[model samples]
Target: MAELFARDTLSSQRWRRRLVPNQSFTLGRSTQKYPVVWDKQISSQHAQLNWNGVQLEIRKIEEAANPIFFGSRPRISFMLDPGQHFVIGHTEFLLENSEPTMPLPHRSPRTEVTIRPEEIRRTSFRKTPGRIELLTELVSKMTASTDHDQLITIALQQLLHGIPHATDVQLLEQSLDGDTKTFSPIAWDSRDGVSTPGGSSQSLIENATTSHMCVLHVWPNEPDPATADFTQIAGHDWAMCIPLEIKLNQVAALYISGKRARLEGNLTEVEILQDDIKFAELVGSTFANLSRNMALERRQSQLNQFFTPGLLDHVSTDIESYLAPREAGLMVLFCDLRGFSAATEDNIDRLIPHLHQTSETLSIITSAILAQQGVIGDFHGDAVMGFWGWPVSASENPLGGIQAAWEIVQTLAGTEFLCSDTPAKAGIGIAAGQAVAGMIGSRDQVKVTAFGPPVNLASRIEGMTKPLGIPLLLDDHAVTQLQSHPSMPPNTFLRLGSFRLSGLRQETQIFTVNSGEIAWLPEFSQALILFEEGDWPQAISILQSLPTQFGPRNLLLQYMQGFQNQCPASWSGTIERNTK
Candidate 1:
């Protein structure tokens, strides 16, 4: 085995890693084997190295953006023997043939005893009034406490009251790097309520961890020469360390210490028993469980920003299987606020308040989607994109996107904003089809979103809302899905005609939810069918009978009048849009 030392001269930071004889490791900015996040110049997978017991073999990756320099010149490949060094960016790496060593045992003289969990008698603590009160208070406080530090404090205070022999209590966290171990005190207190530092024994702490049991160290009146050099704290005559079960790659322990009997201070000697150890173990177990739960909650809260509760629950069960990138059927929805540009321009003097209004309105859009168990894919300015049928197929609710769009339209109609002149209105577009959905991006950053035709079509349909004078629009596929859905109402879908959305090769048939709002929809639909069939004279007669003020009716009349009320040579009825 060999040790690889990485030192950043700029920050004076150092890290050591053990190298196995035959295994290879890569060093780069984003490589999981060895990441150098501090330096932006180092490319991903910059170099690969392998230690062969005799020497270290290094190879520069062709795709690396930076050069690996040895001595003063750049090298594409090289061999490094023991005691040689190389530099990459601002970091310097050294290869050494020395095996990592553990810290030496303490030099002080003391006696010690170790006890495994099963060796104890498992007796309960004394049922004194003070101990009973302390135990009751600890259980009540731990149940109600949400903060990690507060719970630690409550346990420590209770321990001090229950154990009369304990003079100091500490919650210690151990961090490991290679063969090195570092212990830091999280919360500590003495019987007098004032903390004194450096009363913990490193060797005893190690013993407790290695044996996964409690360790007690005490100095007898006459120490045996053979065991006199056993490690212990210098000031405290006795100490107990109990290991805690915590997160992987992390170590924690509960440490308690007190002084021995002395002639001058009249401090009586109290024998430590299984009762004290059992009580300490109980507190440690509760603390560990609570800490784990709190950590899970924090992660869930962060995940909620992107995933709905149902999706989150599925991911929680099998994250790798659910989040793996795959092709899936998706219903994509794109909702964008109307007249936002003009509204922003109108509130140039009160930009802050206008921004608040924009955020609130966007929240309404996102909430409606999430309420229907949809995933928020992305956001662009005042627009928000959401999708359904991912992780679990939308087979259960194929009309989720349409349902959410209707809710958004109903909610935003009454929302008042700082820019009162511009009404709070939004254009919604929905499309259902095949798309690649799941977590996508490099290891450094990732986004959960869907990609393919449906996403683009949804965005294009949303843009059409403004030109077609409709608040909501859906692609033909979405309407087809809703037609067979049991929850949808009959005769609610009205065709808006086919369109060649900008950049799309296939013509998309657009439709809107009628809801009987437009009284002339029946006559308008009649004209639209005739117009699409190139029967311009018949379509014009129906259009002329309808109210001219209706936005869709007027728009259709203008299109035919553009070619002198006669069907042109290219009369496909597919309106070709030049812009999105």
Candidate 2:
């Protein structure tokens, strides 16, 4: 299948007829016929005509537009050059013969096309220096599109006006079993859909092994049923036949046409019609490659640097810092997988995939956190440390952390993996306080990691979750801050009284994660409550105790570290929590 098409396209009949201009093209006062007018005027400026696969240069400017059409005869008359007639096809070129020339269409090496003066009459030529310029302009505009629909829309619009005779513009997509889903490709372009001579609302595209069959017929029977690859349909005095080449059924083709009442001097002339086919093929290839790159970029943009691609792009220091030289409040989160090491003893491969899936699930949750203005700090071999209030300073880092933890628990616990039924569980810890955030790493791996005492405390609390049979625990700072908020979700938060979080002289207050639809919201609102109550010490304590796991915990850890050293030590030690 791959080696089917040869590089020799000089012998095919698909080459467009080249026009030999005798007189310069006559410009008319017709604003409707040609909407675009280039101010730069330099005739016979080494212009090229691209037909099926041939490239022919026009020595003189007998007449030409951006892409003149020969498929239709003019309602009026136009001048033509004699010695070297041009043909439009996959490429554009001049015919050496004084009379009609042989077809130069092809499968490969789609250039060096030829046409006699008698073969071509209608044609539009742009003043582009070369194909590179034409393709560059197309690439710039097509990729600028925001979405898939917008990209298609713009392409459609350009085709309507750019082509010589294209009407009732429509796009078609192929389906399985060599069938087609008609009346689609509603992508926007410069011009909307318009009716044309050969236009039809209904279309059938047969997706085949080697080639595609596009048939458009009237109320009568199908046209040329015997022809599997190439067939023509003429109804209401209009006809169009498309032959497609396919590889692995990845359906793709370009269909462009328009209506014109007056076609003469070379109307339906083999030279002119062939040119249109080649032109369509080239346009299709250029546009397709350009769009694929744009889509790839768009996908990369949506991902978080750490989880999206764990690769490098633009690493900005100022952009990375939440607290460059001052202080800011933050929320810390700690996430650790329970029984993970034991479960993976013999099932390392199984465990890895499960962990990946869990991490992906957590990544989604973290995106939601950042969407609401949050961040993740670090990932610690199955453990996570996160924070907010820097990178995107919001008063909800603590609450956001809690929300992230609860979501992970619910999303994982409910999911049953077909590959392995390892218990999906995570321990989460939340805190609030001052910390520093900015770029801090070697050239090999530069990232925005946080530092401070609050981060360490969060780590201690996370380590204690399994021992206490508690999946989530919020500190004094998070509890007081979240409770004061009226929009906090309705959940039962039990006051686990006072608890020691390793190395801390005083017993830190903690809260546990529970079930409910709105569990995530409270996690976001916790930071606001802590700051409002003016519990600076407790806030710093909770904020510093972030885990080193992969999701929100990492962000919280970063934020808390950035703030810990800068904040005031004044704190209120009341860690009260409520849930329903």
Residue range 409-446, candidate 2, lDDT tens digits: 56654422111134347766777778775555676865
Per-model TM values vs. the true structure: 0.60, 0.36
Give me the runs in candidate 2 sitting further than 4 Å from their true place: 1-326, 349-373, 396-398, 412-424, 488-492, 513-580
Q: Alpha carbon lDDT of residue 169, candidate 1? A: 83
lDDT per prediction?
Answer: 0.75, 0.43
Q: Kindly report which residue pairs in candidate 1 clash with one another.
A: 389-394
Deviation (Å) of 176 in candidate 2: 55
Task: Encode model 1's per-residue lDDT on 339-397: one tens digit a residue.
Answer: 78999999999999999999999999999999888989988898999999887789866
Clashes of 1: 1
Best candidate (score: TM-score): 1
